[model samples]
Target: MEESMRECMRKLALWHTRTFKPIMTHDELEPIMATLGFLGLPPSASPGGSLAWKEYAHSSSSSSASSGGGGRARPRLPYPRIDGLHSYTYQAFVDGVSSYLEMCDISVLFHIRGMPLHRLDLYKKWRRMQEDESVFVYREGTLDQATYNLYHLHRRGGGGSNSGDGDYINVKMYYGSGDGNGSLVIRDKGNSAPVSCLVPLKDIIL
Candidate 1:
């Protein structure tokens, strides 16, 4: 049941990710390109579509064939695409940005640092999610900070955030090929008894 639930969440995040409008192609952005051409400036480093590809590929069968065969595969987008994912739209749904979520998809979740998102090469990612992403975050800070502060606030001992709600877990999928994943745990990070924040999205028949 837990496995199925995780898969469902992964798909939900992916389905949500694919629903958005894709990158705009070069032709669709012509007015901007024209202005760039006038100023003797290059177009967008990586405009969305096939035209952007042709620009770098140099079209082996066309007039630029002479250059295509010998030249390096240069990026046409001026800047790297990795630099473009900083916006909120690209944040994980767990982070409160539901639009272009990349976090929970199993292919992206089990391992860390997958890039170009479209390319799903499993071997490329070396670290497991738990190792890098499992640190708990509380409201304004981390689970460690929140709990420690709450402890002090109660005893009149130290400054605290005054609360212990785990809002927004940086969720990730667990994949074990069946070994380490089965290792059960009694406590979460910060050495505190774990709290289960998961809520059922929908259900019935109690």
Candidate 2:
């Protein structure tokens, strides 16, 4: 039953992050608490079920479950604290999801020329990708700006690296005609034995 309680609280923690609002009001929290109140009861557990069976099964202990002719009310159930951090706060919730999430760096490949004239823009690319099942997308716990910058297209690797490191994090479409990206011509500092090659943009075009 402790494990069941932990599992439900973990989902609540996830919801708090998904809404991008971690601070919940007392009234807002009441329903969630009430839902969890019966987790150890007969409707929720199995035969000879749980170590927590006594706590939630005893209706006399809880005001919500008790008759009007009641004795002292029992205290609220403790926070599941599955992450082992005694505190429950926004940072703790963020840490929990970050740990739970399967994170990876993204590489975006796109072409603007194929878009319909009526809706000609880069933002459409994001919307298209969102609808594509092949593309993996997830919502952020907090709102953020979508900052896409237009830069002179630079081929990451034709024969060799463009930057100091061989790794490249970004790839972009050339915005204008007669630009550098179509066959990168790299020359040594001494301007000797210039290397030229093309990183094809055919895969990106619709």
Candidate 3:
């Protein structure tokens, strides 16, 4: 089972590199390509079938020659940032493709990711409910700082005090919305007002 899972992940990674890399615009692909390069893999070719490696190599050689033929300095690669795509959408795409290749249900991806069996069951149940009405359930102390920042930014104005009590905020998910794009809600235990945060589906972890 472990070996099979690894193979699925490998195929998924390769598909992401080959399929999305060529089509994404420079601004969209920059971070992903940088991550691939940092992992000692070749960055994807551009839509025109050209890679920037030649230019980078040329600049490195020129710098080495100018410094009296010392060994060429490595070019600095850009760091990957998660800002362009919606997390849930990306994960769903990956899960869908992987499910197709593995000949398994999408829930298998969630199971492999360590999501609780009960939460999975609950989500499945929620899918069959009415569109306007929904269920909200949450786990306490699950809010990470990065995700909190996303919530904070979405709220726009804030004067909420930060707590250092080692107690993190609650993370909630709303299901059965009209659009079916459920929301992530965050709130301090002491505060009655909660902020609706847009978090990546994978980040929910349960």
Candidate 4:
């Protein structure tokens, strides 16, 4: 059992060094806290809203498993620190980190295009497209109405038509006479006309 435990620790350390270390940035304390939480480890407060791991295994193992036995009692996990720090369970940590990463990726996409980060559906669609390379070409005037409709459907929590609704942004493409030249007509719902003039394809980022 001792050997097995050592092996487990060894593997975990190796995995951390190989996978986690490469991706971790110096400023990513939240991600470190999140990773510890996902491993069911306790966290103590640190500088700059960061968290540090607290060794709790010894204490947890020493706790009583039974009081007077009306039923089989279990040891209680430690509570969050008294300093009003954020604490999380394994699943909660995973969820929070996943959400944060998704938002970060979405932000990068919007930043690349110099677009405002106002549309949740658009972000979702972009993420999906990233995962599936065959979905759509990443170029100007490649964003079609179908993709927008799909984005809208997903944003509405997946139970709707492809038709225009008040919740979706509508985009139209216009091709110019010159090769590789086009413009986009963008309009939001509940608007009488296009909100902006035709934007040139070359001006947009992928």
Candidate 5:
């Protein structure tokens, strides 16, 4: 890692060591993004007929709060349509986001730092379309700050877009407790654990 990147990791480690503690539930954590100036990151656009999608995805799953069914099935809304994108859609983005959360363990430093979230080549596996997208992840637990910083570097293009034979960024995803402070993670190539960064949607080009 470059000196600047290493320094960033140290800072993240310090922050994590200091703030490691219990985290709030997803409901309590959503508001912090807005309060922390991430409100405009992306407009809350749900796609039309999402209810139908949910109804189909979990047709047999029961809507029990005690069971694991409460958090996954969300009401569908109208989202913006990406013109000319062969496979991109709000559903793909949502699927990718869900996979990241379900599969990746965001608490460990080395484990989380090795996630392949930005690998467009593996879009088919993640069930995402080839189009512009924005995603987010949040959880509660202890994380190695340096690992988190490495993830941010990947997301911000600091990690050169190269991974072996494929053109990609080798960065792992990030994890944050729902306490307002958090990191963003993306995938490239097959799967990459990326560095974390606070990317505001207003600054995003896609």
Candidate 6:
């Protein structure tokens, strides 16, 4: 068992090194977060004239969640610390999906380029691959930014490194284009050489 654990860890590390490449940028991350509504409340103009009202609502929700009253509260999820929008072409998005999967400890359901990958076979294989390894792989599909319900994979675990390596962490994001497809980014923790994929905007949960 010890040996097996070591092997898994070793493979995981190796896989991360090979599959995880630098993609995306701090500037690019901001817009994606904003579009996804992950960034805390933006400035609001009101009689109070302060962001306090936004915080109040956020705090209320958090407090309710803490009390365990079974309120469906949005958990505080980790997002990029950097500021700005992630700009990448659609091709980049597709390549990045494989890397995105390896970085997740928890499952992430993402929609991109009008190809929602919710089928039982896809999800099952994704979970299975994730449990035993850490490399990105892709299967060919007719992914267009239009006329398709984009697919996605999100990490349920708070976004962080599994290896405790400060150099890199796995990250994901969503982008909005006027086209039917939105954008999804999966790249290194440092936002280098990211693989950006497009998804049909209609497929996004929001």
List lDDT for all candidates, in order: 0.23, 0.23, 0.27, 0.25, 0.26, 0.26
Decide which is better by TM-score, 4 or 6: 6
TM-score for all predictions?
0.17, 0.15, 0.18, 0.16, 0.22, 0.19
Clashes of 6: 44
lDDT of each residue in 21-103, candidate 1, tens digit only: 22333333233323322111233323232221222222222333423233422213211122121111112211211111212
Q: Write the per-residue lDDT of candidate 4 for residues 112-188, one digit (tens) a residue.
A: 11112222323221211222222221222223343345444443553222211111123332222222112234545
Ranking by TM-score: 5, 6, 3, 1, 4, 2
Alpha carbon deviation, residue 144, candidate 5 (Å): 37
Q: How accurate is candidate 5 locally (lDDT)?
A: 0.26
- Residue range 37-148, candidate 2, lDDT tens digits: 4223222222353312111322324435631113422222223221111111222222222222212210011111111111221122222112222111111211112111
Indicate which candidate wins on lDDT. Answer: 3
In terms of TM-score, which candidate is strongest?
Answer: 5
Residue 142 of model 3, lDDT score = 20
Off by over 4 Å in 2: 1-21, 38-206
Please state every model's RMSD to the true fold in angstroms.
19.2, 24.0, 18.7, 21.5, 17.4, 17.7
Clash number for each model? 3, 0, 0, 0, 31, 44
**Candidate 2 residue pairs that clash:** none
Local lDDT at 74 for model 1: 22
Q: Which segments of candidate 4 are over 4 A away from where they belong? A: 1-5, 8-90, 100-206
lDDT of 6 by residue, 1-206 (tens): 73343222211111112233221232343334344333343322334332111111122234323221233222221122111111121222322332222233211333221212223323321211122243222222212222122222211242222211111124343323322222234454465565544232222222
Candidate 6: global Cα-lDDT? Answer: 0.26
Q: Model 5, which residues run further than 4 Å from truth?
A: 1-54, 57-60, 63-101, 105-193, 204-206
Runs of candidate 6 exceeding 4 Å displacement:
1-126, 129-168, 180-183, 191-206
